[model samples]
Target: MHRHRGVAALAAAVVLWASFALTIRGIGASGLTPVDAAFLRFVTPVLLLAPWLPRALRAVRRERPGVVVALCLAGLPHFLLSALGGRLTTAALVGLLLPGSVPLFVAVILAVTRGERVRGRRLIALTAIVLGIAATAVLTTAGATTTGIGVLLAAGFVWAVYTIGLGRTRLDLISVVLVICTPAALVAAVLEVTGALPVNLTSAPVSHLALFVVLQGVGTGIFSTLSYGYAVRRLGSGIPAVIGAISPVLTTVLAVPLFGEPITAGVLVALALVVGGVITYNVKPRDRAGSALAGPPPAAGHRPHVRGLQPHLTTGVVEHPAAAGQLHLQ
Candidate 1:
């Protein structure tokens, strides 16, 4: 694994997400709607990745193309649904439910589909994420809605699956973005055409549109998506979730200055927990003092494959296919 590259990817993704949250918060503070913002989300990516469309289309059509294309749907509706749900629900609920539970969703998917067990430190790190996200939610001055809860949860699930798919397969990032964003832009175009989601550039102040293109379009849509894919490509599936879980903290921190949001004791504590969890999650077995030894693996499926992670472990020594080295475990 290109460990450094993964770390860089994870870092870039986390920064983009944090910026995304901050932008969303700013939108919430204004009378401006996110419909146009959502529209821009899809369109920006389409334009940015236009050059790579042909190749990405080829990738999407190849080797489980349907699955890849289906996975592509994850990001398309997230912004729109989340925007609609926000109108129906509280900001706090939206924040807590979506980013907070995404990790659990990913963990379940990996365990059930990939048969990757969440044992030891992974579990501990996950628990910390849960706790941190919960704390952040409690500190948030937002509202609630029965319907909004469902929408946000669905959003969380979509993103989790999206993250998992990125790590699960070896696909070119640009191609995946092309496959995903093209249809997403089309969806937004449909909404605009139907007048279901009105987009009036003239009606909206010029300043708002500028912000939308800069933050929502370029930052969140292009940079965020590419960075996350890169991060997942590097960090694998686990720490990306950890990094994502911490985005709320970044939101809160940035929101304090940008959105005139306050930082409460709960916010401080939540930040601590989130930061701690990220640290813990990134701590590899080699980082710990004689890190708690992992046992052996089962006879099948447990053999160390260098390219990706495997499951059904007995916890003995597993040979790393790429490293061609032994993972010394308990």
Candidate 2:
């Protein structure tokens, strides 16, 4: 049976992520520095989701030690790097560039390392993502912060590795997420406590921290942990990837209308291209026979994987081989 629940979860992820852009705009309006903003974003999610620690730790104890370690290694760094990158770059640029980079990185790494052949539809989807992002970039100006863009790009690469790494592991849904998030939260909180943060939340910027709480605690800490796996179980791996293209478009559109940030021609182009790419990629060839009638793609049935470090940021369903306890490729 098609799982509508996964689709709903994916949709929620898209909305929450897009709202992330607006949240940045809100912080900007509040006159906080990007570092403080980024710190809060990361820290809040950890705090809000801290309640899950007991269960998460129990799951960790139940799972293989190596698998838990792998999850922490793969997922934690991505979030750490991405949060740092966001401090350097504009949220719109991050939105547009990050997600667009994942499939490309995944395909190349897979082909080279695992000997997995990249196929037609995935290739086309990749092409569409690039072209759409290019069009968006051309239409809008990200203010000549090429260095910032580079940082975000590196962050994206870290996330791409995380996504691929998820495929290699055999951990269950709760175990996998906890393994990733617990360490990430600890790391980020440590940084905050140690004064690595750019803006001092102790001063005038206290109000902005509340926004951070909302963004991380509700938007990421809670939702992302479950969304990817749910989508995978309900919809399928490929479908969520395609549907995720909606994130950049939705975020950019909402930024201006709701947050009063000016919308640009580039944003519009990006929106169109992303939608087009997603549609093109999701559609199957008529020549192929299938068991069920195609409607809007069903939800995937896997738990969410963190996307904090990628070019765009993310979550996805993953299924690991039963005995491998290692990363699996889709």
Candidate 3:
């Protein structure tokens, strides 16, 4: 039952994430700047989750300073980069590069920081993902588009660091969400009030404002993070990560009609490679003990043990610092 709930939550998160790409790409038509969109994104959750602020603050004091910094980097800064990149390029590319490149960046970070080895299929999958990203970059014609890709790649790297840091922290889902969103919302509010960033929330068309408030504020800001975190807690990181590979395809297909973005052959090839690589990378490998280690597949009602995580048998939820941190929607 818990696993089923996790799958449902993960599916919802994937759709929400695709809509995020669409909304960011459509910010221009809505008469909102990236800053305006980002403000809406950051502030809504902070307000709705206000009750958890004290807990989040307590967690921050206990967490490593670097982990807090990583969470902040993945907040407003990541959103701005993603928004700018979405504006400069197609929504298809925004979907493609942001999530597509994350695993590769995570792998590199792990290798450099921890000297982790990537052997077998995982190495091959990373290589395929890298080639796909390179192909997408090489096929771009416009300078602005190229720059957008670079920015999105940088955003992916920042998010990867956040993913690692999340795994290291012991904060619960609500605390983690508050920790990331509160500071970003405060900073954005100050910027808007001080005339540093443009303010259009009051003057933009009601329809546009409503759309952003619902989609960016409620959907991406709150539900996406909460749902994804819950899904990770129930389902573990591997299944949800593999299932998330569908976002690029879903976003690209939706964009064709919504934004009239053309799907080129090159984009198709790149998407296939990236999606395929992500799936391959998440496949569980056989144990060294061969057939005995392989063992039988879990029964229909059996909950698989998530490697590296301690399960809370009473609650049936996996507790890990990284579970809630696996979110990559930004």
Candidate 4:
């Protein structure tokens, strides 16, 4: 039953994740800058989850300062990079490159830092992901720029760091949400007040504002975070991760009609390779002893050891906020 719930939650979160890519790309029509959209994204969660701030702060104090900083990097900075990259490139590339590159970056980070070996299927998965990203950047003529590809790839690496840092902390769902959103909201507010980041919140069309507030704020900010985390807890990171790999494809398909983005042969090839690689990476092989060795489903919030990259789940369903930013590829 719990696994069923997790699958449902994860499916919903993937849809929201795709919507994030769409909305970020659609911001120009709404008269909101990337910064403005990010402000709404960060601030909404901070205000709605304000009651958990104190506890989250206390937890932060107990954590290594680096982990907290990593969490913050994954919030606003990641969002801005993604938003900018989406603007410079097609929404299809934004969806494909951002999340698709995460596991590859995670594997590289782990291999370099922790000496975790990537052999067997893991190696093949990473290879496929690399080829996919390369093909998209080099072959796709679907309005993608070199600068945009670089920015989204950078965003992927940052989220990879956040995923690693999240595994090192013990903050629960609400606390994780607060810890990431609070500082981001404050920074955005400062930028807005100082005239560094433009604000169209007051004059933007009501319908546009409503769209962003609901999709970016409520859906991506709150619901995706909670649902993805819940899915990880109940299903163990592997299943949800594999299913979540579909976001890029979904986003690409939606972009066709919504943004009139063209789907070329290069885009389709890139999607096939990246999605296949992501699913391959997330799948855990059974041991020689098979189901007997596989033991029962872990209790809620228990982290199961799945080979390759998996997002670290904290207590409760609120792990990392990357899900909200469209990189739920974690």
Candidate 5:
């Protein structure tokens, strides 16, 4: 049941992302400033990743400057924008703008850059998904100002680019993460040294600070990524990527009980649009003969053909710190 396994992996990713919404909320409530909170998320992760730095060093050196720079943008800046934006707005907005809209961005990027054709059903699916995102924006709380939406959209753009950048880099997950984070950590270290970060960030409740470190560092940073990549391998990245559109719906529903938020008709409608759109996108078209995804398994010795399937970011789970291949997307 490879399909079932893929479903389970995507389900696990959804759960982790739902937790991520709450954790960003906790950071906002704490005494930590945006920069301070960004630093806090990276602190333990930097330390945890220190010993493995040497493994990534060579790749860091040899990789083209432009790719490394793009990775760096996707690394700390992406998190800083989203984490800070999460603080500035509702977690619902954070979930809605980032993960919810990424698939559309991926499709646009593939079409524009690779000359990949989007036709028939895919176009309709993309249209519904875009409408769904628009509906979420319409549900915006009075508290969700222009700035907050801008921040969330910024986060979404960077993450979409990050996913695109993945195809360009040859580095495995862990090494790329290391290369990405090392420069960012250095920048944060400079900020801390310059007294730009809060002087008493440690004074924020130790329990809460520890919560941020553990969840951001270990849970979201490591485990969720591994699971998402696993699903990509099992189902091919296309299915899981489309399935990930449901993350916003899942986060909003779970938040009703966890954060005491109320449900609304808009969210329900958005959920329906997204789910229907994703399912429609995956269906094989009947009118088109020799459809790309409709063929049987290839003969032995022939590499299987796929249309629009994303390359796996990493082969398998990281067995150790030295091998902790990149597990991103959260």
Candidate 6:
């Protein structure tokens, strides 16, 4: 894949992810217990990727023993809290707030722990994202369901922790996800088998259990994990973080149709600010002059290379020559 195509693929992944809020709402609309719904969502992914578990586990043992264990511990709160939040809140709010919260928290954490200072464009971008989120939340407050608003706030905090955890740990994508998910699956299964999960879907007329299979299994499991890995691999985590800025706007816009919610000027303005900030943050000064003269360009993809203590993994379908300074996976 070329650079442009890789970017398009990344965008498509976000769009696919954007669909998840709607799906989750549909499941929750059916009135399933949060635990039951969460159980299905968490376990489906493990089963879908179970075939690859051996390879993922081997990678864990080789490169990230401590990280592998930490994943389980870190993911417990991330999944459980978010799952509960989703069930208690509107899908639209939970989805939008979580992404909006990630960048701000990631910046703070990186600055404190890694000594990575937020500078120049990044600082501005971070500021704009924070302002946009505040604006949207403030404007939407009167209209937001109180329950949804409360749950979304909690969800945002949980997501912030997860985002920081990712930066803190050095682990392969598959291995880390597997480690996190395996334990989550065990806990959920325990709940279900112990009769803590209500199974009244037969009378409820909506089968959220079935819906969880698609939402977590296909959407969160395959699409989310692949998109995340590929995005970070090909473009670096910064690019994805920039692109994720639009997630809040995407969820809000999509919700207009899915939930019959009204779209106001506040949402559009917030989207504009967020998009502008992201562009400013990611664009290099020299690219301005080159961009005008450029015609069609090649797609961008993974060009793995040595970076710090970890071996960089290629993110997308793009491949590069050795001379380009990218390391080929052995």
Each model's lDDT comes to 0.52, 0.52, 0.69, 0.71, 0.58, 0.51
Error of 1 at 241 (Å): 8.8
How would you encode candidate 6's per-residue C-alpha lDDT over 10-64 as one tens digit per residue? 6765665565555555555666665565566667767866887897667567654
Indicate whether candidate 3 or candidate 5 has the larger TM-score. Answer: 3
- Maximum-lDDT candidate: 4
| Worst ten in a row by lDDT for model 1 | 313-322
- The TM-score of candidate 3 is 0.85
lDDT of 5: 0.58
TM-score of each: 0.70, 0.72, 0.85, 0.88, 0.77, 0.71
- Worst window of 10 by summed lDDT in candidate 3: 311-320
Pick the winner on TM-score between candidates 2 and 4.
4
Q: How big is the positional error of residue 21 in model 3, measured in Å on the Cα after superposition?
A: 1.1
Better candidate number, 1 or 5, judged by TM-score: 5
Candidate 3: segments with Cα more than 4 A from true spot: 1-4, 232-237, 286-330
Task: Residues 8-124, candidate 2: write the lDDT tens digits.
Answer: 876776676665544544554565555455455545544654677677676566655644554564344544444455555555655666555655666777789778885787578
RMSD of each: 8.9, 6.3, 6.1, 3.9, 6.3, 7.3
The pairs that clash in candidate 3 are: 167-322
Shift of residue 303 alpha carbon in model 5, Å: 18
Q: For candidate 5, lDDT tens digit of each residue in 101-207?
A: 55566677677977777778768877887887677667766655457767766766666566556556667666765665666667776786788755446577887
- Which regions of candidate 1 deviate over 4 angstroms? 1-14, 28-32, 84-100, 133-151, 224-247, 287-330
After the best TM-score superposition of candidate 5, give how far the Cα of residue 83 lies from its true spot, in angstroms. Answer: 2.4
